[model samples]
Target chain A: MALQLTRPVLRSQPRLLAAAQFLPTLMFATVAAALVELTLLRLLSRVAIHIPDVPALRGVYSAAVQAGTVTFPVAALLAAALVTVAAMAMLPRAPILAIPALALLGAQAALLVAGESALGTAAHQWLLAVALLAVLFYSTSRRMALFVAGVGVAQAAGLAQAASANLAAEGGRALPLSVAGAGESLLLVTLLAAPVLVGPRRWSRRDVIAGGVVALIGAGMLFGNASTARTLALWTFGLGMPLPALLYAITAGAMAATLIALLRTGAIERAGALTLIVLGGFVPPNSYQAGLLLAGVMLLVLEQPRGPATTD
Target chain B: MKWSKPAVLLVGALVIAGALAGLTGVRTATSQAVTLKAVAVADKPELNPDWATWVKIPSVDVQLTNQAVTYPKGGGTVPAVSLKAVHHENTLYIRASWKDQTENVPSIDMAAFTDAVALEFPGKSAVSVPSFCMGQPGSGVNIWQWKADAQAGAGSAALAKLYPNGYADSSGFPEELTKAALYQPAFGLGNPVARTDAAVQTLVAQAFGTLSAAAAQDATGAGMWRNGEWSVVFTRPFSAADGDQAEFAAGKNTNLAVAVWDGANGDRAGQKNVSQFVTLQLSGELVKAKSEDWGALWFGAILGGVLVVLGLAALGWAGVAGTAKERA
Candidate 1:
């Protein structure tokens, strides 16, 4: 009887100790390292200290890019690992979703190994959408599941918009306004407002004060100078360029509220991961932003609260 | 170790502020080393895209992104463009080519859109490189844009060329009216798009939606479509009449960005594939110049510092206030 109890505990301990808690930390560290390399070593150095005449600094930039290239496949593999773990957890309960999830995980891993492009592009959008939908089966709450579904649909639509031009080139129909342009704007508002909508009530006085201060800083950065402010705003929100007046106001307000909610609810890590994923949507997967985004998605998948095993 | 909520918020704010400061110049690192070396030739290269010398000159293939931030944004039609550059005498010649199955030339029809491409360069007055997308305020950009319809007579004879069987009776109009400038206001006003004589337009933009015809129309180019591909060549002198245009000289390095539009995909204005800025080298040895703009750098550094100080102060205040409340 004691051996039996110890066996179950031993099995659970390996997973929890080896993969469960450590995975998110590993993904976060990888992402942090990549971002530091990209922003500090590459971009900031180029702007602040990397003089054009300095061949050594230029080499540093090249080295950073090389490092990013290597990190990309590793990041993809970790993402695949997360999906595999989630699938295995759901295998006995919901094989319908689990089997397909495993199949996508296989394809994604194969693509990564074959040096194919990352997910979220025209070629890989369908795979990514299906994988996201499959992951929704493990959502801890209906609201969270709905949110994931919305993100999947929006992401797929954005990818389809990229493919629309090729279709139109082949004598197919075209959209009047860009789905990506509108979708990004809508998503910015939605993401920034999500925490508030699903947040805990009764904000602490300290949290409110903190939120107010952040809101001021955000407003000042986004609405200060005409030239630099717009650039900063574009980067922060990752919304479509040439920011319209109405959309800009909406996003700014949403960001403020979200910041308050995040502080009040103390859901910093999850919100941070989601924010990275949203910001990554602005650029192609080939960019450093995509590397950060992949890490963010992996962190979220690993950190998600496990639901009861399905009986189906 | 257990961490307080205030400490986590403070740390998070610091990280975010630092990250944003570092990402201000993020787009600069988006592209790889794409050098369009302008080979020195003794004589002016043939204007044809199929020029023999072009075959000898190496080309740089630039990957393009169809994800535009502005309106009417849906494009990936031409995934990439190949660029080759050569200099003969004081003139610089650049050839750009991309794949396209259908040749689209704009007509007077409301639905018709022309295939177009443009090369954007920092204005001669710009102290630092501007945004790749139109440009930024204060720092402007000069664009040399070419259109298929302009090469084919700017939609004037496009109806006749596209539909040989379709006819309209123009004899009903009075002869004076037919010849009057009033009949073609845009062409009479020297609008580049309406003008039939030029295939390329010299334009300048301060930011998005700010593109306008430059005072000097010194640049010209032509486009040829064959074998399901379109190749366009733009030629301009090494120097411009004024600061509104981009000035180039041998041995000097400059940034070059390209935008391609597919008429079949209804790409126009903001809807087009764009490449990140790449280095363009003239015939002489590449010379990397030091930046002379210290004010902008100082401003950025100071702004980041201020944000860090402010964020820490606010979060620290929150922490102290929470501690006092607990003690009370």
Candidate 2:
């Protein structure tokens, strides 16, 4: 009876399957696009010796060319193509996944524009945004979406709380500024990864690896300069481990509890535990901010209980 | 398990390679040396004594008691004549000591404060002597010694003619005699008229009297006088032009030579040209001088430590990534 129920459910949820199949391909494409953009930007800088400045318009034009035209479009097209191929292969009739997928793509575009300004001239912001969007598309599901939205709300609330706490310190502004900056990046990654995490399918082995690699590379690029590396190393040594270690520990405990609970009753008690663990990690201001964000997203997606019918 | 061993070896090799690269950039030690010398000449009339016994010079002076005269070292066993002249070409040699550990002592300007020999020639008229050439004999010139004495209220009535500025009073006859005849004058004796031929006889007599009184005052001088063999050497005056001067040279000629013993202890001997009345040689070595720029090394070490931490972090990230991949 369980087998019979699973087969029909698997056939019905084609969008989730397609997203899972496309995750790795999308990540590889985004990385390729970023490399190409980086190379082109370097070449253009060498060749365009006497380019005229256009006041306020120059920054906008430069960013659009670098982030939108070069990095974003390439990453998006590659992701879209992979998703389309996977969808066709899995179940061509289900078009509902396209709605969330397209919405994920739009969020990627917005992220690219914002990131182009924030990450400075060195990074391929648009490519990173697209890669994030692909991760979200792969994970999309109602529960995962609500969890991602909740985490984003938590980060926003944290930023507001940091601002309010500024009055307690001499240079009160720094606490709020750091919170906003960190929270914004976390939000972007969460938003981009939401659709995939909340999707009806489980993550494949390849999907997880690709997701982890993309996240690591993105974090490294953002914080890998000499000054940033030194700051991170110093803080890690002086103040114990990175802030995300606590989150990992909590997440591990939750997972252990969830596993025990699942073995006995197959209930979704794990999701709540994992959520608490992720929240614990996200609370600290330390070098593990990126790790916490990625971990939180992963825990939210993986801990959700699947119905017996959807097990296939 | 087969793959694990090779992976571990590769990681070990990387760590070793990084450490080797860091060690290779370490800095090493390095050094350079410097030298100086001076000479004297005598006049025809002064040739009887070979002009070794200088009668007049503006910068420095030397007077020997009837018993203090001595033959040149390593020359002969004969006692030098106090009233007569003895000449063996006199030379003073000096070696400034610098150890390998010593740093930041540049070859340039090392001669400025090392050692110097000056010549003083007293005059009947104190006003005739230039300010650079007056001081106690054997003692170096104290360019402002007279001024210092005045400030101390130890002014002399006789020094009124010496310090026209009223900065100091006259020096007492016996004290002034010993100072003028035996040491380099604080003020330079640039003029021939300043060290009058007439004053030379009286100055020598006064120096003799002071020595006799000091001998009576202390039994040590009398004992040394009775036991020690003494001698004197006089050189001919080369010319008046050479009398009030200074020069630097190395090796053995008439220039004054200094030999530093046991790193810090030193002995000075000067040769003067009484004909022109100028300083021939002045040299010596001083110890315990300070080193330069001990700060920069510490700064570089701090910067290097920071670079090391970054390199380690890069390695750490690679390690974590490898583990994650293995688990996946």
Candidate 3:
């Protein structure tokens, strides 16, 4: 009886340990896939959008557009699956936090399977807002927690505003500015500055230099010509940001600096997650996009336990 | 127990590979959408939705949402639309259908509204597609809008014939006033709203407030309502002489967007269901215009490719250099 009991215990420990080890890697994969789906796909679409009328480049544009559109949803779906698995793996370690996150994801997946009805869309939006809150709750670092909370609030407000905007339009009256659009822009600007505000305490000399170069380049783009700013504004506008072009230019520069800081400090997963969140902002309001944004939030905030089965 | 470095890396690679393989399968399924082949028929496809040729071709169900980006945003009146297209000779006929419980026709009554649908295409000379909304500055769009009232008025142009119950007795007005065409400013100025020549209006816009009638009027359309469903057909030639109009060619890929307005839902300009741009493949052999200079476009494409490649390469090099320095 003693031998059997010990044997079972031995078996469970390794399995738990394996899951613990697997969580970070799964999160990394999730981040990578989401980045490809959101960022890379959007970039390709931008290129295609700009060159659709060029006869010589028509073939290239057509092929790229088709490939990008087809693969983006697949990448998003894959990221969702990986995130779900990662959340499940975290259950044994931090069941209290992981359960709600996992439940939210599970509910989203089930709703998606049923097709996006009006009821389903509303439910998904609320669940997404809650999921961001879960991210805020899961953060181990105080500074990161604050940032996540702010982002969560902004995202929730933005979603609510978008829904209301739809209703308000029915009155045949127009608002001076779209609150949802402004909120989304604010969220993006905050996210772009995240690395500077909430990153590692000390940065390497090389990191500082690299970040400087990125900033200079961004500044040059912003001040160089009206076209760059115009393009950025148009791109953001297409994604639903009705803000000025100058604001978008400044944010683009900040985005570059943040990425350099994160990568240099060895936050590869965070860098990828950040990219996803930023790109997710630009995509049209949809359930799958919202879920992916939440996934980015989860990956950015969820801290993996250092040891096996540490019930934090 | 400590895991070996190589073993960990191997497991990680395998997991990523498995995920990629699954995604590839999904990609394959999605790629099938790119091959939305247009049916080629010898005879001119009839404008009727129930025509034998139209039913034989495949149909795509496109989801739509409200025009939230602009004011008057209450859309989702019609959740989805079914589209079928065919090319016969030099003309392309596109049929769009959606389900509705009531048919709202245009009327002289101030409270009455007309059901309308429009197809938007990017201008031929645009460096990029304009805003999916009406359009953006710099880049323009060509719009072909068909209204239920316009269709109803196409056959019977006289106001008396359209609204028999509504009496507009010109008997009270002086004969001189009735004879003076200038008295009717809208019709005299060639306003599309006042004209009854065609059911479809060919329009151009640089942005929201810039919508106006196009110089070229090559497209025509009609709508029929039966069994609580509206089927609208848009017919246009493969090309238009005016630069403001979108040109379609055989065996070329173009982008298309759709919008629908339900009169009963108080849907009108900017308050209608809309769709994102979808790739439209016209079936045939692409005959390049040899007279135009292709060198400039080729150079621009090459330059863009080079810039992108360099940017990516720099990022990769920086990453590698950083890792090497850390090891050192």
Highest-TM-score candidate = 3
Q: Which stretches of candidate 3 lie over 4 Å from their true place?
A: A1-17, A31-40, A52-56, A163-178, A204-244, A282-284, A304-312, B1-144, B147-198, B201-328
Q: What lDDT would candidate 3 get against the real structure?
A: 0.59
Report the C-alpha displacement of residue B114, candidate 2, in angstroms: 45
- Please identify which of the two predictions, 2 or 3, would achieve the higher DockQ against the true structure: 3
Give model 1's docking category. Answer: incorrect
Interface RMSD for each of the candidates: 20.3, 30.7, 20.3
TM-scores of the first chain across all predictions?
A: 0.63, 0.29, 0.73
lDDT of 2 by residue, A1-312 (tens): 111111112456655654444333332333344344334432232222224456655565455434422342343343334333333332322232233333433443443343211112111212212222222322324445444555544454443433223211111111333443455445434433443433223334444444455555534533553222322222221111224433322323333433333323432323322333232233233212222233334334333343322322
What's the number of clashes in each of the models? 0, 88, 0
User: Which interface RMSD does candidate 2 score?
Assistant: 30.7
Q: Taking the tens digit of each residue's C-alpha lDDT, what string does model 3 give over A1-312?
A: 000000011234455445545445555554555555544445555433445467768777556555555555555554555456556554443344445456656666664454322223434454555556555544555556666766777776665444322222111111223555666666766755675655655666766566566656656665674443334433433334355545555566566667777777777767766665664553225544554566667667544222221222
Superposition TM-score, candidate 3 onto the true structure? 0.50
* Deviation of model 3 at A84, angstroms: 0.7
How does each model score on TM-score? Answer: 0.46, 0.20, 0.50
Q: Mark the regions of model 2 whose C-alpha exceeds 4 Å error after superposition.
A: A1-24, A27-100, A104-227, A230-312, B1-328
lDDT agreement with native, every candidate: 0.57, 0.28, 0.59
Q: Which ten-residue region of model 1 chain B has the weakest summed lDDT?
A: B25-34
List the candidate 1 regions with Cα displacement exceeding 4 Å.
Answer: A1-312, B1-33, B167-182, B285-328
lDDT of 2 by residue, B1-328 (tens): 0223433343344334433432342111000000011222233223221233332211111111111111111111111111111112332211111111111111112231111111223322222212121222222221100011111122334245344576525654566565563453532343321322211111111111121111111000000011222111212222221222221223211212111101011111211111111112221221111222323532453355345334433443444455447668
The CA lDDT at B117 in model 2 is 18
